[model samples]
Target: MLTEEGKKRRDALDAEITERIAAFKVEQRKMLEELAEIGIHVEMVNRLPNLPTSDYVQALPILIKHLRREYSEGTLASLARSLAAKDASEYWDELVAMYLASAHRISTGPGNLAMALAAAVAAACPKNRLDDLTNLVKNQRLPHRVLLLTPFKKRRGRDPAVARLIEELRHDPALAKEIGRWKILPSQASLRSH
Candidate 1:
Protein backbone atom coordinates (compact mmCIF):
# COMPACT_ATOMS: atom_id res chain seq x y z
CA MET A 1 0.00 0.00 0.00
CA LEU A 2 3.03 2.28 -0.18
CA THR A 3 4.51 3.75 -3.32
CA GLU A 4 7.85 5.47 -2.73
CA GLU A 5 6.43 8.95 -3.25
CA GLY A 6 3.51 8.25 -0.90
CA LYS A 7 5.91 6.96 1.75
CA LYS A 8 8.07 10.03 1.38
CA ARG A 9 5.11 12.36 1.62
CA ARG A 10 3.85 10.56 4.72
CA ASP A 11 7.25 10.81 6.34
CA ALA A 12 7.47 14.49 5.57
CA LEU A 13 4.04 15.12 7.04
CA ASP A 14 4.95 13.23 10.17
CA ALA A 15 8.12 15.23 10.56
CA GLU A 16 6.21 18.48 10.15
CA ILE A 17 3.72 17.46 12.84
CA THR A 18 6.56 16.51 15.20
CA GLU A 19 8.30 19.83 14.60
CA ARG A 20 5.09 21.78 15.23
CA ILE A 21 4.51 19.87 18.48
CA ALA A 22 8.05 20.63 19.63
CA ALA A 23 7.61 24.32 18.83
CA PHE A 24 4.33 24.39 20.73
CA LYS A 25 6.00 22.87 23.78
CA VAL A 26 8.76 25.44 23.64
CA GLU A 27 6.23 28.28 23.47
CA GLN A 28 4.29 26.86 26.39
CA ARG A 29 7.44 26.65 28.49
CA LYS A 30 8.34 30.23 27.65
CA MET A 31 4.85 31.41 28.59
CA LEU A 32 5.08 29.57 31.90
CA GLU A 33 8.43 31.19 32.57
CA GLU A 34 7.03 34.62 31.75
CA LEU A 35 4.09 34.06 34.07
CA ALA A 36 6.47 33.00 36.83
CA GLU A 37 8.59 36.08 36.28
CA ILE A 38 5.51 38.21 36.67
CA GLY A 39 4.90 36.72 40.17
CA ILE A 40 2.35 34.06 39.11
CA HIS A 41 4.48 31.30 40.75
CA VAL A 42 5.07 27.76 39.48
CA GLU A 43 2.24 26.16 41.44
CA MET A 44 -0.33 28.46 39.88
CA VAL A 45 0.90 27.74 36.36
CA ASN A 46 0.92 24.03 37.15
CA ARG A 47 -2.67 24.20 38.32
CA LEU A 48 -3.74 25.45 34.86
CA PRO A 49 -3.97 21.90 33.58
CA ASN A 50 -6.69 21.18 36.18
CA LEU A 51 -8.43 24.57 36.24
CA PRO A 52 -11.68 25.71 37.94
CA THR A 53 -11.42 22.78 40.40
CA SER A 54 -7.96 23.61 41.72
CA ASP A 55 -7.27 26.29 44.33
CA TYR A 56 -6.73 29.54 42.44
CA VAL A 57 -6.75 32.21 45.15
CA GLN A 58 -3.02 32.82 45.08
CA ALA A 59 -2.94 33.40 41.34
CA LEU A 60 -6.14 35.45 41.05
CA PRO A 61 -4.61 38.87 41.46
CA ILE A 62 -1.75 38.18 39.10
CA LEU A 63 -4.09 36.82 36.45
CA ILE A 64 -6.33 39.84 36.78
CA LYS A 65 -3.34 42.15 36.49
CA HIS A 66 -2.35 40.50 33.22
CA LEU A 67 -5.88 40.12 31.88
CA ARG A 68 -5.20 42.54 29.04
CA ARG A 69 -1.88 40.98 28.09
CA GLU A 70 -1.37 39.32 24.69
CA TYR A 71 -1.59 35.75 25.98
CA SER A 72 -3.14 32.98 23.91
CA GLU A 73 -6.93 32.66 23.95
CA GLY A 74 -6.67 29.31 25.72
CA THR A 75 -4.73 30.89 28.55
CA LEU A 76 -7.36 33.64 28.93
CA ALA A 77 -10.16 31.07 28.93
CA SER A 78 -8.42 29.07 31.66
CA LEU A 79 -7.93 32.16 33.78
CA ALA A 80 -11.60 33.09 33.38
CA ARG A 81 -12.78 29.60 34.33
CA SER A 82 -10.55 29.58 37.40
CA LEU A 83 -12.06 32.88 38.47
CA ALA A 84 -15.52 31.35 38.14
CA ALA A 85 -14.71 28.47 40.55
CA LYS A 86 -14.72 30.80 43.56
CA ASP A 87 -16.64 33.76 44.89
CA ALA A 88 -14.83 36.37 42.81
CA SER A 89 -17.37 39.07 43.78
CA GLU A 90 -14.61 41.19 45.29
CA TYR A 91 -13.01 41.43 41.88
CA TRP A 92 -16.25 42.26 40.10
CA ASP A 93 -15.02 45.51 38.58
CA GLU A 94 -11.86 43.97 37.22
CA LEU A 95 -13.64 40.94 35.77
CA VAL A 96 -16.34 43.07 34.15
CA ALA A 97 -13.70 45.35 32.68
CA MET A 98 -11.91 42.38 31.19
CA TYR A 99 -15.15 41.01 29.76
CA LEU A 100 -15.99 44.34 28.17
CA ALA A 101 -12.53 44.68 26.73
CA SER A 102 -12.60 41.19 25.24
CA ALA A 103 -16.20 41.28 24.09
CA HIS A 104 -15.20 41.58 20.46
CA ARG A 105 -13.13 38.40 20.59
CA ILE A 106 -15.66 36.28 22.48
CA SER A 107 -17.52 33.38 20.81
CA THR A 108 -15.36 33.68 17.69
CA GLY A 109 -13.35 30.45 17.93
CA PRO A 110 -12.66 27.18 19.77
CA GLY A 111 -11.42 28.54 23.10
CA ASN A 112 -14.42 30.75 23.82
CA LEU A 113 -13.26 33.38 26.29
CA ALA A 114 -16.72 34.96 26.28
CA MET A 115 -18.39 31.91 27.76
CA ALA A 116 -15.73 31.63 30.44
CA LEU A 117 -15.91 35.33 31.28
CA ALA A 118 -19.71 35.17 31.40
CA ALA A 119 -19.51 32.28 33.83
CA ALA A 120 -17.05 34.19 36.01
CA VAL A 121 -19.21 37.30 35.94
CA ALA A 122 -22.29 35.27 36.83
CA ALA A 123 -20.44 33.89 39.84
CA ALA A 124 -18.96 37.25 40.85
CA CYS A 125 -21.62 39.80 39.97
CA PRO A 126 -23.17 41.49 43.04
CA LYS A 127 -26.80 42.45 43.51
CA ASN A 128 -25.90 46.11 43.12
CA ARG A 129 -24.39 45.54 39.69
CA LEU A 130 -27.57 44.21 38.11
CA ASP A 131 -27.94 47.32 35.98
CA ASP A 132 -24.43 47.00 34.66
CA LEU A 133 -25.07 43.34 33.85
CA THR A 134 -28.20 44.33 31.93
CA ASN A 135 -26.17 46.73 29.86
CA LEU A 136 -23.70 43.96 29.08
CA VAL A 137 -26.56 41.88 27.73
CA LYS A 138 -27.39 44.63 25.28
CA ASN A 139 -23.85 44.73 23.87
CA GLN A 140 -24.15 43.49 20.26
CA ARG A 141 -20.46 42.61 20.11
CA LEU A 142 -21.02 39.53 22.29
CA PRO A 143 -22.85 37.08 20.05
CA HIS A 144 -23.37 34.84 23.08
CA ARG A 145 -24.86 37.72 25.03
CA VAL A 146 -27.57 35.47 26.43
CA LEU A 147 -24.95 33.86 28.67
CA LEU A 148 -24.83 37.15 30.55
CA LEU A 149 -28.40 36.52 31.68
CA THR A 150 -27.44 33.62 33.98
CA PRO A 151 -27.30 36.02 36.93
CA PHE A 152 -30.82 37.20 36.18
CA LYS A 153 -32.03 33.60 36.07
CA LYS A 154 -30.61 33.09 39.57
CA ARG A 155 -32.22 36.23 40.96
CA ARG A 156 -35.44 36.65 38.93
CA GLY A 157 -37.74 34.78 41.28
CA ARG A 158 -36.61 36.89 44.23
CA ASP A 159 -36.09 40.23 42.53
CA PRO A 160 -38.67 42.13 40.53
CA ALA A 161 -36.01 44.01 38.60
CA VAL A 162 -34.48 40.77 37.37
CA ALA A 163 -37.89 39.32 36.51
CA ARG A 164 -38.77 42.42 34.51
CA LEU A 165 -35.45 42.33 32.69
CA ILE A 166 -35.98 38.71 31.63
CA GLU A 167 -39.50 39.54 30.39
CA GLU A 168 -38.11 42.50 28.44
CA LEU A 169 -35.38 40.38 26.90
CA ARG A 170 -37.95 37.74 25.98
CA HIS A 171 -39.95 40.37 24.14
CA ASP A 172 -36.97 41.69 22.18
CA PRO A 173 -36.95 40.37 18.58
CA ALA A 174 -33.15 40.32 18.54
CA LEU A 175 -32.81 38.34 21.77
CA ALA A 176 -35.93 36.11 21.84
CA LYS A 177 -34.32 33.12 20.07
CA GLU A 178 -31.30 33.05 22.39
CA ILE A 179 -33.49 33.49 25.46
CA GLY A 180 -35.65 30.56 24.35
CA ARG A 181 -32.60 28.43 23.68
CA TRP A 182 -31.16 29.21 27.10
CA LYS A 183 -34.43 28.28 28.74
CA ILE A 184 -34.22 24.78 27.21
CA LEU A 185 -30.54 24.16 27.81
CA PRO A 186 -28.92 22.88 30.99
CA SER A 187 -27.60 25.48 33.37
CA GLN A 188 -24.22 27.00 32.52
CA ALA A 189 -22.67 25.45 35.66
CA SER A 190 -23.62 21.96 34.53
CA LEU A 191 -22.35 22.63 31.00
CA ARG A 192 -18.98 23.71 32.44
CA SER A 193 -18.37 20.19 33.72
CA HIS A 194 -17.71 19.07 30.15
Candidate 2:
Protein backbone atom coordinates (compact mmCIF):
# COMPACT_ATOMS: atom_id res chain seq x y z
CA MET A 1 0.00 0.00 0.00
CA LEU A 2 3.02 2.36 0.36
CA THR A 3 5.13 3.98 -2.34
CA GLU A 4 8.77 2.76 -2.75
CA GLU A 5 10.26 6.06 -1.48
CA GLY A 6 7.95 6.12 1.56
CA LYS A 7 8.73 2.51 2.51
CA LYS A 8 12.45 3.13 2.03
CA ARG A 9 12.37 6.16 4.37
CA ARG A 10 10.46 4.27 7.04
CA ASP A 11 12.91 1.41 6.96
CA ALA A 12 15.86 3.81 7.19
CA LEU A 13 14.39 5.52 10.27
CA ASP A 14 13.80 2.15 11.94
CA ALA A 15 17.40 1.17 11.25
CA GLU A 16 18.69 4.45 12.72
CA ILE A 17 16.78 3.98 16.00
CA THR A 18 17.93 0.37 16.28
CA GLU A 19 21.52 1.47 15.79
CA ARG A 20 21.19 4.14 18.48
CA ILE A 21 19.70 1.73 21.03
CA ALA A 22 22.36 -0.90 20.43
CA ALA A 23 25.12 1.71 20.77
CA PHE A 24 23.62 2.96 24.06
CA LYS A 25 23.49 -0.55 25.52
CA VAL A 26 27.12 -1.17 24.61
CA GLU A 27 28.16 2.14 26.26
CA GLN A 28 26.24 1.29 29.44
CA ARG A 29 27.81 -2.16 29.65
CA LYS A 30 31.29 -0.74 29.14
CA MET A 31 30.84 1.81 31.92
CA LEU A 32 29.27 -0.59 34.44
CA GLU A 33 31.92 -3.24 33.88
CA GLU A 34 35.02 -1.02 33.69
CA LEU A 35 36.79 -2.31 36.81
CA ALA A 36 35.94 -5.89 36.04
CA GLU A 37 37.91 -5.44 32.85
CA ILE A 38 41.07 -4.90 34.93
CA GLY A 39 40.71 -8.45 36.27
CA ILE A 40 42.47 -9.49 39.46
CA HIS A 41 46.09 -9.30 38.46
CA VAL A 42 47.28 -10.99 41.63
CA GLU A 43 50.64 -9.27 41.42
CA MET A 44 49.28 -5.72 41.27
CA VAL A 45 46.38 -6.18 43.72
CA ASN A 46 48.42 -8.31 46.21
CA ARG A 47 51.32 -5.81 46.28
CA LEU A 48 53.84 -8.26 44.82
CA PRO A 49 56.41 -5.69 43.59
CA ASN A 50 55.17 -5.04 40.07
CA LEU A 51 54.48 -1.79 38.23
CA PRO A 52 50.81 -1.17 37.50
CA THR A 53 50.11 -0.21 33.92
CA SER A 54 49.40 3.54 33.99
CA ASP A 55 45.60 3.70 33.66
CA TYR A 56 44.63 6.18 36.36
CA VAL A 57 42.38 8.27 34.12
CA GLN A 58 40.67 5.18 32.80
CA ALA A 59 40.27 3.69 36.28
CA LEU A 60 39.25 6.89 38.07
CA PRO A 61 35.52 6.31 37.58
CA ILE A 62 35.74 2.80 39.04
CA LEU A 63 37.83 4.07 41.93
CA ILE A 64 35.12 6.64 42.67
CA LYS A 65 32.52 3.89 42.79
CA HIS A 66 34.57 2.07 45.44
CA LEU A 67 34.89 5.20 47.62
CA ARG A 68 31.18 6.09 47.75
CA ARG A 69 30.08 2.54 48.51
CA GLU A 70 28.45 3.38 51.87
CA TYR A 71 31.20 3.28 54.47
CA SER A 72 30.33 2.56 58.12
CA GLU A 73 31.75 5.93 59.27
CA GLY A 74 35.28 4.66 58.90
CA THR A 75 35.04 2.25 55.97
CA LEU A 76 36.71 4.69 53.63
CA ALA A 77 39.57 5.10 56.11
CA SER A 78 39.90 1.36 56.25
CA LEU A 79 39.88 1.16 52.49
CA ALA A 80 42.42 3.98 52.22
CA ARG A 81 44.69 2.21 54.66
CA SER A 82 44.44 -0.99 52.70
CA LEU A 83 45.21 0.97 49.54
CA ALA A 84 48.05 2.84 51.25
CA ALA A 85 49.56 -0.49 52.21
CA LYS A 86 49.86 -1.07 48.47
CA ASP A 87 50.01 2.45 46.95
CA ALA A 88 51.78 5.76 47.71
CA SER A 89 50.79 9.19 49.15
CA GLU A 90 47.58 11.18 48.64
CA TYR A 91 45.78 8.18 47.13
CA TRP A 92 42.72 8.93 49.22
CA ASP A 93 42.84 12.64 48.47
CA GLU A 94 42.79 12.03 44.72
CA LEU A 95 40.05 9.41 45.14
CA VAL A 96 38.07 11.58 47.56
CA ALA A 97 38.17 14.55 45.20
CA MET A 98 36.48 12.38 42.59
CA TYR A 99 33.92 11.19 45.14
CA LEU A 100 33.14 14.70 46.42
CA ALA A 101 32.76 16.04 42.90
CA SER A 102 30.33 13.20 42.17
CA ALA A 103 28.31 13.89 45.33
CA HIS A 104 28.30 17.61 44.61
CA ARG A 105 27.22 17.06 41.02
CA ILE A 106 24.46 14.63 42.04
CA SER A 107 22.88 17.28 44.37
CA THR A 108 22.40 14.47 46.88
CA GLY A 109 22.11 14.72 50.69
CA PRO A 110 25.89 14.81 51.14
CA GLY A 111 25.89 18.41 49.89
CA ASN A 112 28.18 19.79 52.58
CA LEU A 113 30.37 16.73 52.18
CA ALA A 114 33.52 17.81 53.92
CA MET A 115 36.44 15.63 52.92
CA ALA A 116 36.03 14.01 56.36
CA LEU A 117 37.68 10.91 54.89
CA ALA A 118 41.10 11.19 56.52
CA ALA A 119 39.73 10.82 60.04
CA ALA A 120 37.75 7.77 58.96
CA VAL A 121 40.85 6.15 57.46
CA ALA A 122 43.03 7.13 60.40
CA ALA A 123 40.57 5.39 62.71
CA ALA A 124 40.47 2.17 60.67
CA CYS A 125 44.10 1.81 59.58
CA PRO A 126 47.58 2.43 60.95
CA LYS A 127 47.34 6.18 61.73
CA ASN A 128 50.89 7.18 60.83
CA ARG A 129 50.46 6.56 57.09
CA LEU A 130 48.16 9.55 56.35
CA ASP A 131 49.89 12.65 57.74
CA ASP A 132 50.03 13.99 54.17
CA LEU A 133 46.24 13.71 53.82
CA THR A 134 45.78 15.63 57.09
CA ASN A 135 48.01 18.35 55.67
CA LEU A 136 46.31 18.30 52.23
CA VAL A 137 43.09 19.54 53.84
CA LYS A 138 44.95 22.51 55.30
CA ASN A 139 46.39 23.31 51.88
CA GLN A 140 43.33 22.55 49.74
CA ARG A 141 41.06 25.28 48.35
CA LEU A 142 37.47 24.78 47.25
CA PRO A 143 36.96 24.92 43.53
CA HIS A 144 35.78 28.21 41.94
CA ARG A 145 36.84 30.36 44.89
CA VAL A 146 38.11 33.82 43.88
CA LEU A 147 38.77 37.16 45.56
CA LEU A 148 38.68 40.40 43.62
CA LEU A 149 40.46 43.35 45.27
CA THR A 150 40.42 46.51 43.17
CA PRO A 151 42.27 49.02 45.35
CA PHE A 152 43.15 51.07 42.26
CA LYS A 153 39.48 52.02 41.78
CA LYS A 154 39.59 53.86 45.10
CA ARG A 155 43.34 54.68 45.25
CA ARG A 156 43.42 56.78 42.05
CA GLY A 157 45.64 54.50 39.95
CA ARG A 158 43.29 52.94 37.37
CA ASP A 159 42.71 52.78 33.64
CA PRO A 160 39.75 54.66 32.27
CA ALA A 161 38.98 51.79 29.90
CA VAL A 162 38.62 49.33 32.83
CA ALA A 163 36.50 51.87 34.71
CA ARG A 164 34.35 52.38 31.64
CA LEU A 165 33.94 48.60 31.20
CA ILE A 166 32.90 48.24 34.83
CA GLU A 167 30.30 50.98 34.46
CA GLU A 168 29.13 49.65 31.10
CA LEU A 169 28.75 46.15 32.56
CA ARG A 170 25.85 47.39 34.72
CA HIS A 171 23.82 48.25 31.64
CA ASP A 172 25.13 45.39 29.55
CA PRO A 173 22.43 42.76 29.49
CA ALA A 174 24.85 39.92 28.60
CA LEU A 175 27.45 40.83 31.24
CA ALA A 176 24.86 41.51 33.92
CA LYS A 177 23.03 38.27 33.23
CA GLU A 178 26.24 36.26 33.40
CA ILE A 179 27.36 37.90 36.63
CA GLY A 180 23.91 37.53 38.17
CA ARG A 181 24.13 33.72 37.94
CA TRP A 182 27.51 33.52 39.75
CA LYS A 183 27.57 30.89 42.52
CA ILE A 184 28.71 33.46 45.04
CA LEU A 185 26.17 36.13 46.02
CA PRO A 186 27.35 39.62 45.13
CA SER A 187 26.45 42.58 47.33
CA GLN A 188 24.36 45.20 45.51
CA ALA A 189 26.89 47.96 46.26
CA SER A 190 29.89 45.75 45.43
CA LEU A 191 28.21 44.54 42.25
CA ARG A 192 28.17 48.15 41.15
CA SER A 193 31.68 48.83 42.48
CA HIS A 194 34.53 48.55 39.98
Clash counts per candidate, in order, are: 0, 1
Per-residue lDDT value at 95 in model 2: 47
Clash count (model 1, backbone only): 0
Q: How far does residue 23 in candidate 1 sit from its true spot (Å)?
A: 6.2
Q: What 10-residue stretch in candidate 1 is worst by lDDT?
A: 184-193
lDDT of 1 by residue, 1-194 (tens): 99999999999989986765454445456556666665554533424536443444566666665555665565567667767744667788888877777777635333678777877787778878888888888766665676677787777666666666766687666678866665522333333344
On the 0 to 100 scale, the lDDT of residue 60 in model 1 is 65
Model 2 regions lying over 4 Å from their true place: 1-29, 40-93, 96-116, 119-131, 134-194
**TM per model?**
0.63, 0.23
The Cα RMSD in angstroms, rounded to one decimal, for candidate 1 relative to the true structure is 7.6
- On lDDT, the leading prediction is 1
Pairs of residues clashing in candidate 1? none
RMSD of each: 7.6, 17.9
